[model samples]
Target: MKAAVIGLGVEGKKALNSLLKYGWEVYATDLNVNINLDNLPISLSSVDISPQNDKISFVKDNLSIDLGFNNQEKIDSCDAVVLSPSIWGSKIAEHYKNSGKLLCDVKTKHRDIFTIGVTGTNGKTTTVSMIKEILENAGKNVLVGGNAGGGFEGYYDLILEADKQDYDFLLVEVCDMTVGFCNHCFDFDLIALTNMGNDHMDVHGSMEGYKNSLKEFFADKIIFINNNQEYKEEFRELSRLAIEYSKTDYDLDLFGKFNKLNAGLSEAITNFISENTFEIDEKIIKNTLKNFKPVEGRLEVLKLNDCEIYIGKSDNSDAIKAILEEVDFAAVFIGTPRHNENHRLDILNEVVNANPEAIILFPGLEDTLDQAKFRLHALDYQGRIEIANNLDEIIGFVAEFSHNPSILIGGNGQENIIKIQDRLKEICDSFNHKENRLLFED
Candidate 1:
């Protein structure tokens, strides 16, 4: 009956509340020593406000939010430990397991609802969002979550909210790391693989390891996979019913061949779900595809007078290649961090091959710009390459000098990319109103 929630980040907070609702004695810990409660999400604020609330009193009285420095004692005393997916495979988790304690991850339980899990190196968020949209358009009560921003932040929150609501389908974005930790714990009716490519090598340690992690997720489930993926055959063998999807050539609102693949995967999953459950009209699928907007930070476009800006969160080489193949950019502002050394080389090579007019590297990357610069030089790259100290410099350069029809701003981290998107939107708004014509002209 007693549970200890580790890592009081977004997922941890949701786990704490869910455990409380399930009538478990919940204790919580956060490794962030400086988390401000006032800045916490409204979800947490709603739960913390009631002093007369039994859950609030139980947590406050028994748990200490002490940066997880003294959490081992609390964890040892608990019957079960619920871990945030971020802490999966960590030393702390291994130590707890060695001590003979029951450990569960965020993906545990929620078997009552019909779940559709989408996993791959790319297109997970978009594909899952599309499935949610298509199902909802068909009048199915659906809750979409896992890895997308705004409202549906994490799977833990989604599962908790779905439990209270009347949702016929729960669309989840399942990451490889999550699958690696708790593959056996997931009870999904169906699953989808967007596409697999070289990504997250730092975590998985090798290409083989990353692929194996994904393979573990599809076992015994009816899986929908992209037919064009290199590892499709491998994935097909593992699933109970493996459905392969190819590019549909639909004039989708989203750009890129990969996105087309995403749409194809989405449609396949929707059709499978609909055929088994209810009749989803073909018009609903077509309309949803035609009108579905691109996921934020994934090839989102903004057009100016002489140039267009494409912002996305593509951190890996394959994702970057997909974007480059779709749009010819005069310049590229890359914010992806250098995690996997081999993948970094591949990304640099792709950037060189694309041969943009300029390449502006931003902060938030693990590898230094100097190193990337050296690699570019080695590749005989002729384009302009500079490392901006901040996002402002990159924006200023693009606003002033970029004359090509399109420019790209994205990679790896969402933090910097989101900031660029907001700032660019503000600037674009001013230009649209003719209030900042002088800025662009200069």
Candidate 2:
């Protein structure tokens, strides 16, 4: 058997190793002209695929390498082509599919473990976490991962982890980037969609394109859709049994109405598993929903002095609006660390329209301050706007600038929001309430 692995990113490398493990002759290629393959352990004789030994060694001895370009001859000679998620829907991917080659996103390959894929523009991470906890509490062996990237292992990591251990189920947090083009290929027994928001337009190009991908993903599957979602009717036409996740007012430790919906989806899916596959105690599902805490950076609350600092994930304008609506904050701290947001200006506009008493623009890898200033000025916003020189400046301003009890912080990306959380924690630890008191305070 022969296989050609395309792209040498995290997922691509994992695919290469896994193929070689199954004794397939491998041909590796990357479009990156200067890709570093020194760490991509070619000699897997001593490779350790454990949780701790994530960074394996690499070389070019065992497989044929065609870096800087995708060699057609090499691809034609292979029986299968494993693609990185980043290259899904590309010309090469289309060619492989049209040619009747066994194309894979590395994630969709046949596996014995039962797979439950959870996907949505929002609340996916929280929902996946909820499902994992519910299953674990029921004493079921499960492996949870895929695109849940707040320091969580991804699908690639899960594949490596699956090689060493036996799991009854794999709870995968699917995203547009990971499974949009090749979802049908994944061997999922069930799928839970949290809700669709106006997000990922930058990647999916438009709402129609995004919805089409999702429709194809859920087609012919035993899927669960949030009842609150507008497209439930459309999905119901395609799914084998489209279960609706009802909204509940369960007394939850997590903040916001969205979380209630997330918990609802978790309950629906876990209950299904219990009824059909496993015997999960109803008490476990109830307790998990009632006590489940918010995932990090999703409506997370931090305290510094008298003010409540809320850290949230605001990847789009809808998310920004949701945060503003849920938390009655007097001031907002917004950043566009990635600047690649589909609606960067719209996100800033959303923050401005919230009419907070003040808005702070913190510097990031992108020039978020400039965009915020332009958008605010254009909107004729009269609220206080402060431009922070650095993360430390944000803390200093928050400490001494406002007497308001609530301060909301968020950004355009999760990784960026996590950074803000870390900085806030550090500053709060060393923060002196007395010396840096607000102007209105003593």
Name model 1 segments beyond 4 Å from true: 1-3, 7-26, 29-63, 68-73, 76-80, 86-109, 148-152, 338-345, 365-371, 378-380, 435-442
What is candidate 1's lDDT per residue for 1-442, written digit by digit as tens?
6788777766677666666665667766675555445423234433433333222222254333444244567677878776677786789867765665543333234556788888888888888888888988888888777653322456555655654566787777877667754453446898887777777677788878877777777777798876666677888887788888887656898777788888988888778767887889988988999899977666688866678888878777888888888788888877646544545556777878999888888764464666667778999989888888786787888786546788888666676677788888888887776846766787
Model 2, span 124-197: residue lDDT tens: 88888898998888888888877734335445556646756888888888876666543645578998887776
Candidate 1 similarity to native, TM-score: 0.81
What's the TM-score of each model vs. the native?
0.81, 0.80
Query: Judged by lDDT, which candidate is best?
Result: 2
**C-alpha lDDT (0 to 100) for residue 137 of candidate 1:** 83
Highest TM-score scorer: 1
